[model samples]
Target: MLLTVSGPPGSGKSTAAAALATALDYEHVSGGDVFRELAEERGMSLGEFNALAEEDDTIDRDLDRRLREISETRDEVVLESRLSGWMAAEHADLRIWLDAPLDVRAERIAAREEKPVEQAREETVTRAESEALRYREYYGIEIDDLSIYDAVLNTARWGPAETTELLVALAESYDPQTDEGTFPVSGVRYEF
Candidate 1:
């Protein structure tokens, strides 16, 4: 049972995903962490990482390949990525999309990274735009779209624990083999 959590920058997707994975005893795989590790290994900054991803198709391909390989063996894994919803279509028992207000997201990023709010806001907007553009150009993927997901969540009102509880409820009600291609039990729709 593969589960995926996706959202825009600073939307608490990682926090919620980790909590969900822990509650369900699932392995957690994060694309953002993978990208960060890869970038560090190559001795590059975040901007450089985005730049390289834009210029190199091989990087994204390799990342996707590794994710696929992991998913094959893990019975219940929580995968978090900008493109997780799309990638997990075949394997995911449930896909969750986390959403938060821009201001809230900016605040979270600033506080978490210890940066000036204005600087964090600028960085967040830039990274978000760059990621959307590059992912589309490089892989024909639009992470902003929620149609690919089984559930859409607004994290602005809920804390990580509450969100995890909700996800667990959804997961408990989900039967992957029979529920394939079905929408979320919550029946919430995201406006593109």
Candidate 2:
């Protein structure tokens, strides 16, 4: 099964995806990790790299293309990225979108990065806006649109354990062989 987990920065997507992968014994690929690695290689901070991305689309396209290739060629892998769900929408068996309030996400970022909450909040907002604009300009994808996701979870309301458990259960029950276009499980909806 190919599962794509996507959310805004600090939405706990990587945590949830990693947990789900461990529980299911599946390989996990994280686009953010890859992006971060690239930034580190160039000795640039994430915000600086993001600004560079505005002037040059190659960086985003390169990472996104790699993600698409992985999603199309791999199975039993959880693909994690902001646009992973959208890029892999046609190939992914399950697409999940995790959501949390901006303030909650900002707090998480602050804690993770060991920065002040206000600074983290500002950086997060700037990065999000930059990504949204670039995504639209380059791929005609609106990052705000979550209609492509098969399942939507509010990370703020549901803790990591609860969210991971729900995803694991969903994965355990999915059957592709006897399936229609919709999810195999009943009561599942593509929600924003």
TM-score, cand. 1: 0.89
In candidate 2, how many clashes are counted? 0
List model 1 lDDT by residue over 1-192, tens digit each.
888888988999999889988999988899989988999999998778877887887888788777777766677899998778776677777778898988899999899988898988888888888878867886688766667876788888888888888888777777776763323433444332
Residue 139 in candidate 2, Cα distance off native in Å: 0.7
Weakest lDDT window of 10 consecutive positions for candidate 1: 183-192
Cα error, candidate 1, residue 175 (Å): 1.3
Best by TM-score: 2
Where does candidate 2 have its weakest 10-residue lDDT segment?
178-187
lDDT string for model 2 (110-185, tens) is 9999999999999999999999999999999999988788788889988889989888877777776654343454
Cα shift from native, residue 16, model 1 (Å): 0.7
**Pairs of residues at least 3 apart in sequence or in different chains that clash in candidate 2:** none
Report lDDT per candidate: 0.81, 0.90
Off by over 4 Å in 2: 180-187, 190-192
